[model samples]
Target chain A: MSSGETLPAAQAGTVESMDCLVTIAASSGGRRIEISGSGAARFRSAMENKIIQVLDSLGGPGDLSVTVQDNGALDIVLGARVEAAYLRFREAMLR
Target chain B: MRRTMLYLPGNNPNMLLRGHLFGSDGLIFDLEDAVSRSEKDSSRILVREVLRHSGFDGREVTVRINGLDTEYWRDDLAAVVPCRIHGIRVPKVDTPQTIRDLDDALSALESRASVPIGATKVFCLLETALGVWNAYDIATASPRVTAIIPGGEDLAADLRTSRSKEGTELEWIRRMMIVAARAAGVDALDTVFPSVTDEEGLRREALFTKQLGFDGKSVIHPAQIPIIHEIYDPTEAEVEKARKIVAAAREAAARGLGAVSVDGRMVDLPVVRRAEFTLERAGAMTEGGAR
Candidate 1:
């Protein structure tokens, strides 16, 4: 079931204090999320859940690889960054 | 007392992202007047996303929505009131019904969002002569109102005058607003001085605002924060007097006296409360109310 469509790869936000830089790339699994860096474990589930929620809101949950460079971003910051990256990927894929 | 409130453009993600860096007592994310018509949708979405995501780090967070006549205000309210917003400022408010309507709208939004009733506050931006005349009614119209900001530029236009260097044109409205705010038990905030580079002028104007009983002054720039905070902070002598009044009042209460004498003047509940508030604002008071 391949229509030769692939979501674009893009990143949004920075790994600054109280912020999270989200980089999303097209992939095979429904979702592949990895967190690497300090202070990621405790918030790993929360961040992943938020990313899924944002993608769902954007008509997503598509196959994707999400790399979150965490810097203590709140849920809303994470959501916005994820949403921005998702839109960017979606727009690029259409073009 | 709110010493300084910095307004950041709501549409710009960078500014919205960085609003909490400055040490302001309040942060206003402005959607009206700051955002152009074309960018309203994007800005509205961005502000909502930011609000949905960011914690304001103890600073009071407010969003200034477009006027009721605009097509975007309802959307703006739907986006922000559900978030962690402390207050919503409806700009160019000319009638008490404006406040009443906003209150009802906010209540509906709160119910829709499942947030507690009356959790969100509102600030009336008295930007026109009609708004100024109805300031008292607008301030007291809703229990959610916590502050009234006397608008400078729009208000000047409404008054059919231009802003003067000494602010003579806006003085009377400022006076009236302070009375209205005090009578309504809400904070009266002064408008921003348009001249950002005029440090001396800003200081002078802030001093005038403080003397006129303004709780704080709104700023559109970060540089103006310290100048306004300095003027609003209680002076050293005033802090000392506050300490004395508080101590005397506490001792008198312990001695079963209804009123206390501070510096040979009889002090009562109101003065004691004022003294305690002064110390609190000065950041010198602890649980014991002493330096």
Candidate 2:
């Protein structure tokens, strides 16, 4: 079995206005997603659902940790950022 | 009547989502210079999603891809061409070969995506001295070339100079672009005037380019849109004169005459055609002109 420590982390997006910073890392257990920043107070659940939807579409989250630092990004932006970060993370893990 | 085409940062959600509402003639989502190197991949994804999900309010939407010299251009095209964009603005195009290469790439992408081949147009940005020299060749390079534009800062740098408020550096290049575009039967689009705050300067440059036979100008700021439109839109007096000339020409044509007289001046085929073009620019030909 592979350890999470052997994989590298990957990120996408920036914490700019109407944008978000999404980072994904290898996880040893079940999939986990965390949301924070200016949009988290009111949009944490919605953002989490978006992350889940994108990750699932990309062939499931697998064993990974997704963290989002949003700054008032729309749902579409959030989905794009999550997909980008997860793809990067997946590429890194494969490498 | 594309008097102004505004540039929207590809990576900025706020701009990408709302740029069409600013009342420009078209919108150009910029993925080349506006996006940083580190964010190229992410920006490409973001632009694709935005194009997929958001509507541009029916404005002509295009994207400026990275130059052919870069590794990211093919990826950029693969991302956006499938989105069914109207066209792509390719920068630093120096010869017809560049356009041939781009056309080939786009055809493969469009075919793969089930899009109609040749539906995706190309707008060439002639930024270097060689590019400007080969303007006609580049414009006629492919059937997909709808317009050719002169470069602003990039062209200036390539010419070993910097931009001036009076635009002394780009005058000859602009002239050549208009001539070449017209010779090639394509539209001549002027580059952006970077001094966004200089209203008077922008007006002067727009007027100059319009008089030089440019179809439109690339806009950097939304505020410049109204001014460029004002310059390109036909005035009331001009429209009225055009209508009178068109009416006279219709009567003459009905009588099988070779020439007509409008406002006590002799009008011919060319003059009537010019009047019809004026009516077209005023957006009144089909609505209020002689059939």
Candidate 3:
């Protein structure tokens, strides 16, 4: 999915057992990522680092509101869900 | 030893969550035909996430990526190449070049991901008439390739034929693909049974394919697994015969003989090899090469 157009507010992933739900909302300011769940405090830095990696990978941080409803999903799972949400947001714009 | 390989749509969380409990020899997280075009990217993410967190519990796990002709496959490879998957199943493989190109890309990706070189395997799916003809080349294209699967519906359409309950349309294709797989020293998995509701039909097809010597069959529904396994797995008598053959072969080799007599029949290298493979599949062969 290409950038430049306004991203549609979209969400991906789930909050089901041991999974986290990540919702991506379009923003005009910049990428805002947050995580709240079990052990969220302990893994906040790691999760942020992963979210930053995802944003960099997509060349994003372009106007996005992030909400992570974590449920003990590992860093990789979190990253995948975030990337999916990001891609969903971008893809929604194309449609 | 892959009697049943189930295709679990990658985008469906319910499937991913429940797939491993079905007792299939492998679970193929499908990112190609199973996902809608709009959900492609999200599905890739879901697959990658599932790879990390799903409790596979020793079952073989693989991802079937979109055909290399698509724009989505690049991202598919990039996302899945580094994950702890047994292999990647590339669909619509019509040429050896496709395998070569994918292997090269995967090697590069593995390097970037700090993974062991050639850690991942590749399985090719022949979905086109051209792909069926080129199965040998595709199967032999890379050392990483472990199996070549022939797909129905698509293949039937490609061949300008219609699918039937009797499977006469697929007989020739299955035979040719098995020969190609044999020539390339890889397993050949028969196509799926489209009617998931037909347990009798599934059993018949599985038995027929097993008699044709396919190492496995693809399954879409969990209900079909046990029937496939029952058909493909060697019977108790066959396992016993295999064990005896292995023992006889071992005894013959110890005495400097190139052949062994088992049940008044001469067992040569080929027969002994078959026996050993049977024992291996039956899980009766020990680490010391004894059953």
lDDT of 2 by residue, B1-291 (tens): 568899998889989988988888789999999999988988899999999887776778899999999999999999999999999999999999999999999999999999999999999999999999999999999999999999999999999999999999999999999889989988999999998899999999999999998999999899998898888888899999999999988998899998988778999988888899998877732442211
User: Which residue pairs clash in candidate 2?
Assistant: none
Q: What is the DockQ of each candidate?
A: 0.20, 0.80, 0.36
TM-score of each: 0.78, 0.94, 0.82
Query: Among all windows of ten consecutive residues in candidate 2 chain B, which has the lowest summed lDDT?
Result: B282-291
Task: Please list all clashing residue pairs in model 3, or write none if there are none.
Answer: none
**RMSD of each candidate relative to the true structure:** 5.7, 3.0, 5.0
Estimate candidate 2's alpha-carbon lDDT, on a 0 to 1 scale: 0.90
Question: Which candidate has the top score in TM-score?
Answer: 2
lDDT of each: 0.83, 0.90, 0.84
Rank candidates by TM-score, best first. Answer: 2, 3, 1
The DockQ-derived docking category for candidate 3 is acceptable
- Top model number, lDDT: 2
**lDDT tens readout by residue for model 1, B195-224:** 999999999999998999898888989999
Worst 10 residues of 1 chain B by lDDT: B282-291
Docking class of 1: incorrect
RMSD of 3: 5.0
